[model samples]
Target chain A: MVKPMTKTKFLERLGAELGIPPATLREEAPLNSFKAWDSMGHMSVLAMIDAELGCEVPPGALQKCKTVGDLVALVGSKLES
Target chain B: MITQIASHLPRTVLANEGLAQLYPDWTAEKIFEKTGIRERHVVDEGECASDLAFAAAERLFAGRAREADYLLFCTQTPDYLLPTTACVLQHRLGLPTTCAALDFNLGCSGYIYGLSLANSLLQSGAANRVVLLTADTYSRLIHPQDKSTRTIFGDAGTATLLSKESGSRLHSFVLGSDGSGAEQLMVKTNGARFPRADGLPTTTDESGNVHDPACLYMNGPEIFNFTLKAVPKLVREVLEKAKLSLDQIDLVVFHQANAFMLEHLRRKLGIAPEKFVLHLEHCGNTVSSTIPLALEGVITTGRLKPGMKVLLAGFGVGYSWGGCILEW
Candidate 1:
């Protein structure tokens, strides 16, 4: 059985994918604020989530995520199911 | 055997700085860093695909113009809907009237498809000499304010000569399509389904890029995901068909979609940087012309040599994808 991903782990993974510092990835951090959060970054995040969580994050759903917490919650919900 | 390839780009150049003025949020450097494209050649007003195609074919001829047995012109943007562009080209290029010529509609995957058709024609003994031409003026089909499509597309034409040989260097091909993803990258209007008379209103997407219903619209993320899922499988299939491993191939030439997507696919496939052709910095995605343009670049630069095996892959715009191997 796979372990449930924690918020901290999710942030770390996303940070690595986006080339952002983990310390800067607070739950309230605005995703668009990061220079790396462009179209390519969005695709990389989706790939990272798929690789790390084994869940395919739809591009539409990924686009709906505005804050770091939203992304974590999106992945966490998918993980629960 | 594949004899020679020649490509022609429009004289007008659109640099990143010119695009930066349209999208103030992104600087020229940022655009270059993101797309790996510094500039693209765009056709001037009144120039069409056939003009570019004619120029490329003329260059390929260069006093060696001969009567081709068949002419294959591949493009989504034809000079006219009626009377195939190839027929016009045959007349314009001074090919014999006895030659068979036709137009096939495809986008980025066109070059590979053209090769497959040429190879088949040669194998079947239907044609001794095949002139495969790929050209597009996608710039005319894009909305001026749509930066997503505007920044990435360039106008170009390419002509490749194929002749029958007992030991033909052109080998296996793997082609695929997903029509369901057609809407993801398409011009919703000006087609049989949605006539221009319908007058669909121009709208803007979340990215601030405006789209006229007749203009080209690309869902970048969806296309990226589709490529990620399709290309590796396509590569593997071609390799399997050729009974060769990836390492055995001398070089991989893919459609010049953009720098970011190409880099991502390259890393995913574990292809060595030097073994991969990256020539699109000077001419953004030229739709059907990209692969042949890259092939010409590699040959001119001496990166590709005679007897070397090359893997060619092209994907986009039809959600069409194809891969093939050729011995240079």
Candidate 2:
């Protein structure tokens, strides 16, 4: 069975994996709009989280994530479901 | 015709010093035992992707720079947090500022994507001479302690010149992306924060924390399953798209990921082992450069003759896979 990734953990993990500093990545923040989080960078982030954290963010979850906050909420929702 | 197009690599190198320092006793053989890497290069401490990109592009476009009108750089590692490295490279290479320049963040499949993009531009008359550069300084993203990715990756950069030709250029390309398996290979931590979340945890893997930047993690078995399942299918598709059969290809330049994976892939594809070149022994798993390096090797060795058809493919990291057939 796979464990759920907490909202906080997910963001932290996403940040670390993508090499974006925590100062820039905020909740409800659009990932691609950020300096570090581009399309491929986002993919790398998601790939790392799914593999290392054992949590999978579904397709389009990225679109739902308007802010870093929104991203975490989405992750949390996914975890709960 | 797609004759001997230009390509080149950088001279002053970084050479994976961090990874080397981390594992004093680890050699390419032992590291590759688990992951599929024999060795890799690293950028010099201060050097970024653009340096290598510019170097390779300069060499590949030398005496031909003024001829190119577009530059495409595919890499997971770039110099800045903002401007695309392609723009910097274009300026540095003295390319026309009006030229089309962009950076693509991709891993193993990068080279093929670059080629595909260049082909489209050329076919559309968007450009006459296209410089495609693929480079990754895995040293930049890899965590020293994370055994999963550290072993499999090595920093490398390669460049290829795509020109508008009459007969043969990029024959056909097949590309696919599956988001479901995206997590099988990743580097996590240091991105954004949920409202309640603190900054990234600096804990070691021993702490049982999920996100750690100190390493690259991958479900080896899962990736293996994905590769075995998708690669052969894609290769066949690309071959079919090219209107050629496997037996017709003079050389197969699959990504130089590892000896073991390549061995397994070849066996699964039923490809004669001899049709491909094995340069991973020294160059390690150079991700994007794998195919070009292989092409360079076969060309330098005189194994690939003019007019020979070549099948090139790259897959890894993003669950990304792509391949193309080209006539030399």
| Top candidate by DockQ | 1
Candidate 2 lDDT tens digits, B1-328: 2333334443433234444566664554455553445455666678776777666666676665355688788876777756888888887888887788888878888888888888888888888878788877776676556554555666666777777764666868899898787777765543342332246465542212133543455655456556766788899999889889899988888887767667767865768977876777656677787787778778778998778888989998888989999787
Docking class of 2: incorrect
The DockQ scores of all candidates, in the order shown, are 0.36, 0.02
- Kindly report which residue stretches of model 2 are placed more than 4 angstroms away from their true locations once superposed: A1-81, B1-29, B32-37, B190-211
Candidate with best TM-score: 1
Instruction: Write down the worst ten-residue block by lDDT for model 1 chain B.
Output: B163-172
User: What lDDT does each candidate get?
Assistant: 0.87, 0.68
lDDT string for model 1 (B1-328, tens) is: 7888998999999999999998998899988988899999999999999999999999998978676899999988898878999999999999999899999999989999999999999889999999999999999988989888888999999999998753438877999998878888988877788878365788886567887888888888778877877898999999999999999999999998998889878977889998999988999999999999999988898888878999999998778999999998
User: Stretches of candidate 1 above 4 Å error?
Assistant: A1-7, A15-38, A50-70, A73-81, B166-168, B197-199
Q: Which 10-residue span in candidate 2 chain B carries the lowest summed lDDT? A: B205-214
Candidate 2, number of clashes:
29
Q: Chain A vs. true chain A, TM-score per candidate?
A: 0.83, 0.61
